[model samples]
Target: MNEVQTIDELVISFENHLRSLQRSRFTIRQYWQTWKPLKIFISANNIEFFDITVGKQFIKSKLGAYEYANLNQMQRRLVNTVDALSVFQQTGKIHFGSAPLRRNPPKVFTGEIGILMEGYINFRKTTFGLAKSTANNNIRSLYTLFLFLEDKGVQKIDDISEVYILFFIKNLNPSTLSVNHSTLGVVKGFLKYAYEEKVFSTDWSKIIQRTNYKGQPKLPSFFSTDEIKSILNSIDRSNSSGKRDYAMILLAIKLGMRVSDIAGLKFEDIDWDKHVLTFTQFKTKKSITLPLLPEIGNAIIDYLKYARAVSDESHCFLQQLSPYKKVTAEDVSRVARFYIHRSGISLKERKHGAHALRHSFASELLGNKTSLPVISEALGHGHTSSTMFYLRIDINQLRQCALDVSLVPSTFYQQKGGFVS
Candidate 1:
């Protein structure tokens, strides 16, 4: 019999309706944000009772300022809000949807794309044992494809036909440049995962074909020997900050440790008498050991003796500035990038963060004839195949491994034919 008291109260009621419908947190949040602008318009006009004529006037006025995209989104929110209000009015909770308009059919999208992404996350967790960050990236890749499909007027899970998927992959226009083979792989992988999980009716993956437009595999960029030396030389070791940066770079390049793992290392992880630095990799969750190279040992000793911030925490790396908390992955990468610029190198080339140094280290070792298994162990790669990507970079090693062939017979045959002259 009584209407909602205030705008805030009305919003709360709407939010509660959404929650009761079992909508996702993301959807509920979007709905709330979308409805907020309308509330603002209502309050501004002093037309407060969920009136349709006033709503239409407010939307018409927006046509002057709001672009097509904004208008479409607002319309969608309006539709959902009106629908919810109608439900509430039916229950005698509020007078709602007094203004009636023909509603458009919900657009079709390959919404099963979400199911595929969830499948990838589950697969990475149960099968590959990937770290949270890596698993997250695979999900993001699949999500991006759905966004592309949504832009192309395909919306809803059931709308994703084989033709829809193939056209999306192979026949992308220049403006829709985001869709590529890597994303195609994501779509492909998601479909396979769905089939395996029995989420698809007919193993939709079998019909999904690849266009085979492979991207050029790039060598991971790293500081060359001279660049590394230049960076080290640029540091004023007398300063505490310089000493810590020097030490961090040494660990990054020499030990091939990821910034995340390096930042998480504790003072206790180092064994002085045993001459080893032992720590579990944060990304891989595997324990690894490095023979404390005298240079690395000296760097750590210098940093701890002078540069390291004294703290109750035992992490080897600590924030240089305030709080004296643990260094983050971004912090480690930032320092490395700063030194790179200070070294007077062009930032124009593919800029490398701290992990590039890890890639650099792997490359260096593989170039020096270290076996793939050894490099994998050093890099804390759970699989040797993962480390095998470095082979693509070590061309010299590949050349040297070419079986020795005598050129003498060929030369003599050429001379015997007298063609050499």
Candidate 2:
């Protein structure tokens, strides 16, 4: 909270804040060691106030590279430390334990079309009751559409036409059918909104049709049980952060809980007496319960007993450092990817995300001959139809539909080779 303007002074203040938060001495030392080099770099470069530009320069000078993906674990941690310092100085906000990992460019639109974009976003939120994350996604899609229109010399929603829509569709050049399907849904959704408001002369919504997800649904990435075991085993249970992450990963792998639901879990959601974990699903808003196996229960209790930050937060988990509060879904994914990488599993062909674990959990159930309705309920999906996609990866069941060529030879093969009976 100190309004320290200079990088040197701010670093001292930030360190003091961490100490007050009672962050482990080891973590504090790691941060201190990282900041020491940054201080020397800034001092040598004759820099006064610290910023990301200076931080990047320092990182490049030290590591001889600027690309984040190219950095090793220790080097990335160095970047995170420097980035955390930059954020602390600029925003006066300590992001608690870890530094900010992802930063997206600000979406900018400056015209009447921009105004309508804002109006449409607000309308969707108020009228349709869209969640914040959903609204943000819609805004990103609409931003792309409006950016194209603005380039085409359009200024209002009234200017949106079938021609403009066609150009937009053609310009997308999406890599996959699923991406194309989602892009069209955004266009159609916006068109419907514009037509209902009488902003567009033609009902362009009719001109565009979205693919039926039910007919051609996107297949989710799933992992084998052995792969999941590897990911879980990668976690070091001695640290507080590791304990929290271990528990969170179990929720995703064993319970099929979404990132949002895991991050938003409250203490009240746990029924210790009944050994049940109950919470409302964020995407569907339906309350459901899962049995709290001893392994998961033990993990959570270990975190609570020795790892959970001291705070009045109602959420089951908290940021391990000062200003302890709920974490974002992105934070959960980062943790997931970190361990997934450490586990050394070859997931380059598949998505390395927590959702894959959710898919894996569903597939495991399918392999166990769990019924579709039961899996649907267990997954907190609104319908069994939504859970049917798991069948694609149910190789055991799919084999039942295949004919054994060895057991019965076809007539064509008999004619071609003169097969003996």
Which number leads on TM-score? 2
Q: Looking at candidate 1, what is the lDDT of residue 284? A: 72
Off by over 4 Å in 2: 1-104, 108-111, 174-177, 211-219, 390-421
State the lDDT of candidate 1 residue by residue for 240-272, as single tens digits: 888888888889988888888778889899999
Our model 1 lands, by Cα RMSD against the true structure, at 13.4
Question: What is the TM-score of each predicted model, taking all chains together?
Answer: 0.61, 0.65
Off by over 4 Å in 1: 1-120, 148-156, 170-179, 210-216, 345-352, 382-385, 394-396, 399-421
Which pairs of residues collide in candidate 2?
Answer: none
- In Å, residue 272's CA in model 1 sits off its true spot by 1.8
Error of 2 at 266 (Å): 1.1
